[model samples]
Each structure stands twice: as structure tokens, then as C-alpha cells.
Target: MTSIFDADGKQVPCTVIEAGPCVVTQVKTLEKDGYTAVQLAYDEKKEKKTTAALAGHFKKAGTTPKRRLVEFRYFEEDKQQGETLTVELFNEGDFIDVVGTSKGKGFQGVVKRHNFSGVGGQTHGQHNRLRAPGSLGASSFPSRVFKGMRMAGRTGGDRVKIQNLRVVKVYPEQNVLVVSGSVPGAKGSYVIIEK
Candidate 1:
């Protein structure tokens, strides 16, 4: 998705996602289901990898198989049994949301992880401490360091949502989606594109 822009007002290259052969597993309406939405099932799974109930659900949809299931909000449609949704529902220049898991960067320091500027340059006998985070807890006045400060622990590998991404291209034939920006996770990771 586009990031913070300069004074000139331009958008960055947002990531594209070829969303689905997303099968309509269920639909929700305001009166009966009390919401407007559709549930989509995607990603083929081995029979061994799926449970019996999920297998039955996909079988009823007449879909090959699926490993992940996702739902869209406030999107309404009358889909027949075994009906499938595809990337063709979107076109070029469409703004959409891309959802995926970010890459995991295990444990890191505040300087590398949170981009905090650590101390100063090593000169005039500054010793070995350069990037070490200094002063976490206050000196007696506050008694303790506040919880949930930007200290580094496990970073990334999070469910990240990039919104307003422009759809660059779609290859429904190969189930390939090319968006404008970098997506989370590796190439094989499954991503969700919502319009």
C-alpha cells in the first residue's frame, strides 16, 4: 500500500494480490444472518491435511480442496451451490487491502528493531557500549519503567494489513497476483486481497 507521501502528493507502489478461487462457503444477510458478507475458502489441501468436517464442507462446495478460509465483510451476492470466486472480480488500478503475515525477526535490540538511536559514537574512551539501550526505569521519581515500551523482543511474523493497495495485475490462470508493494512472509505465503 502507499505510505506517507512528500509535499508533492504522490502514492507509492502498493502490493497486488490475486485473491481467490475463493469458494462461497456461506453468506450472511442483515435480516437472517444479521450481517452482509460472504465467506470464502481458499488454498488446496491434501486429504490427509484436512479433517473430515472441513472435507465435507469443501465437497459440498464442489471445490477441489482448501487449507485456509476467510470471510469478507459487507459484500453481498447470490451465489449458487459449488460456485467459486476468482481474481477476475478485480481489475487494474483497483484499490484493495492485502493481508499477510510479516516475516519473523526473532529477538533484536531497540536500535536495530525499533530504530532507536543508541548512545553516541565510539570516541574519547566511550568503551564497548555503543548501541545499548540506556535508562529504561526512571531514577526513583517514577519508581519503575512503564510497561509496553518499545523494547525489542519478537518482531514481525505478525498479521499485517496493508490498505489502499493498487492492483497492478492479475493472473487468474496461474492464481498469481502481483501487487505494487512488498507483501509479508515468503513467496509461497497465502495473502488476502479485499476490495
Candidate 2:
């Protein structure tokens, strides 16, 4: 492996990975389980919030209560028994897709959110109607406005997928994964990236 270094030959690009000592909360098999995937839970919290049933589920796996749990399409070849997956799972220059929730921009106009040309007028006495949608309803046919119309409603704060972001570096010791482009959500949001 080539040494990941910065301009001064210091390792800068290496991302800090906060991988667990995660617990195998649940295991899926082909027979009764009907699938082959392991549910891993990271960032454990107190037992109070977790129910006795769910707590016992984690207990059976030899792990404590966790805040978040996710299941992936697990294959036998990619399986590593009792080992944790960290930032070291990725190498430099690997292309990955990042998925996260985008920042919420509440009740945005068409021009801002949907990029519609709003009632085009800088000429004839344009007053306040600049950002308005011209005609929401057609006069004769289709009396009521169609459903799923792109009107001024809740914008952003949705699941966003950014494709082909180059993995610049991965610092397994620090537990961070830094990609080439911007990610969704705020500064400290959980994002899942896959190959």
C-alpha cells in the first residue's frame, strides 16, 4: 500500500472511521430467515429506551443496546466472521455512492426549488407576481388541478443519492471517511456509502 500523504508528506486525506465493535443484532439465513444478511448495530445507548424484547435480542447476540441498526445484502464471499468493517474496507481512488438526507428548505417557491420561470415580467408593471406560478389550473378541460403537482410545498429534507464520489482517503485509526464531493444533511449526519 502506498503511503497516503499531504503536501508536506503528512497523511491528510486519510478519513477517520468510527466503526464499531458493533454487535451482530440479528442474523438472516435461507431457511426460516429467508435471506442472508447480518444486522449490525452501532452507537449503543441506555437500556431504558430499548424494550425488554429488543434488549433480549441484542443480548442473545452478545452485544448491548444500540441506537441505530442497518441490514445490508450480505454475501458469503464478502462475509467476515467476528471481524468489524472499518474505513479500511475502502482503498484510495475507489468510486463510491453516498446516500443521506438533504437539508430541508421549507415551503420554497417554484423558481428556487423546482427551477420554474415564474411569470416572466420585468417590463409591464410587475408587482409581487414575479415568483408566482402563472396558471395552476387550466380554464376548460381537467377542472381540478392534477394530483402530484409541483406546487409550493415542503422542499428538501429528503433522501438524496450522490453517485460516483471518489474516495480521497480513509483514516482507519481516526474513523473518518472523506470523499471528493459534498454530502447531504448537516455537518454531523450519518451517511452510508457503497461501492
Candidate 3:
């Protein structure tokens, strides 16, 4: 994440994303694959780390092995296999949706996960019950703690889609895009951008 100065001299917060020079690995057709979509590959990877089957797949595309492969449905343009896509696909002031995995906060309690107030005021022999999740349910009727109850459990590390982020800048030469607001995932993690 970084800050950029706009025309009015106001500092705007944004996230710089590598918009790719992604290779088109495959093109699915309605008759052949029962769907229409374009599969794109990004980021270079070592042959030693790539499986033989995947290596052959990349070889068919006339490109080296890529670390990430994503399929985009409903692509408007006519793109063939082995074609490269860059930041020129987007323009300044355009709104796009970014999808990525959020950071993992393993084993979080209700106080942080569900934003519970933590049993209210800490009084009346409430020593360590401040951050505890109050109660489950009735002890007898429908005993089994009812499904879909919000409680302490694993949190984060989920696929999150942030919609309608404006494109602040586009550097086609470097295949980079600067979008307004924060993006999910840690640094260097791959994100899928959709218009």
C-alpha cells in the first residue's frame, strides 16, 4: 500500500498491483468445454517446482511454468492461447473488483471475530470472563447448540472480494496499476482483478 498525490494536491491512499503481462494458457469454448472463459497464467516459477503434467500444460501454451493460474469468464475480447495481457487492459478512473485471500488470524475468539462486547462490565466476580463468549443456548430444549451460531473459531484466510475500487493510475510500461483504497492479502500475494 502507498499514497499518491492527485491533481488537487490531495494525498490519496492506494494499493499498487502488478497488473500482469499474463499469458493466456487456454481458451475454453462453449461447444468444446461447455463454457466460455479464458485461462491466464502469471508469475514465473521454476521447472523443478512444477509437476510434469503442469509443465506440459505450460509448454502447450508456449510459456514457462507460472505460479498462478486464473480463469476469467465473460471476457469480451478475442484472445488466443499464448497471448500476453498487460495493464493496458485497464484505464485510469475505471472501477474494478479485486479478489484475494485475506490474512489469516487463526483461532480468534468472539470478542475479536464477531465483535462481541465481551460479557459487558467486568464486575461481580467476573475475573477472566471479560473476553469470553457469554453463553451457547438453552441447556435442555434444542440442546445441540443450534447450527450457525457465532462463537470462537478460526478466522480470516478466506477468499474476499472487494468491489468498486477506482483505478488511480496505470503504468503500462511496467504493467502496474494503482487502485484507490486497501486490498486484501499480504504483500506479493496474487489477486484477481475484474472490470
Better of 1 and 2 by lDDT: 1
Candidate 2 regions off by >4 Å? 1-21, 74-83
How large is the C-alpha RMSD of every model relative to the true structure?
Answer: 4.9, 4.3, 1.0
Q: Candidate 1, which ten residues in sequence have the lowest lDDT sum?
A: 1-10
Clash count for each candidate, listed in order shown: 7, 9, 0
Predicted candidate 3 versus true structure: per-residue lDDT over 147-188, tens digit per residue: 899999999999999999999999988999999999999999
Q: Write the per-residue lDDT of candidate 2 for residues 1-195, one digit (tens) a residue.
A: 123565566664333334444555666778968878877677768999999988887778767788878776653345433345556767878898878899998988888888988887678887888888778877678778889877888899999998897777777777666676576787667666667
Off by over 4 Å in 3: none
lDDT of 3: 0.95
Model 1: lDDT equals 0.75
Winner by TM-score: 3
Clashing pairs in 2: 15-170, 15-171, 15-176, 16-174, 16-175, 16-176, 17-175, 17-176, 18-175
| Error in Å for residue 43 of model 2 | 1.5
Best by lDDT: 3
Off by over 4 Å in 1: 1-18
Candidate 3: worst 10 consecutive residues by lDDT?
Answer: 119-128
| Clash list (residue pairs), candidate 1 | 14-180, 14-181, 15-179, 15-180, 15-181, 16-179, 16-180
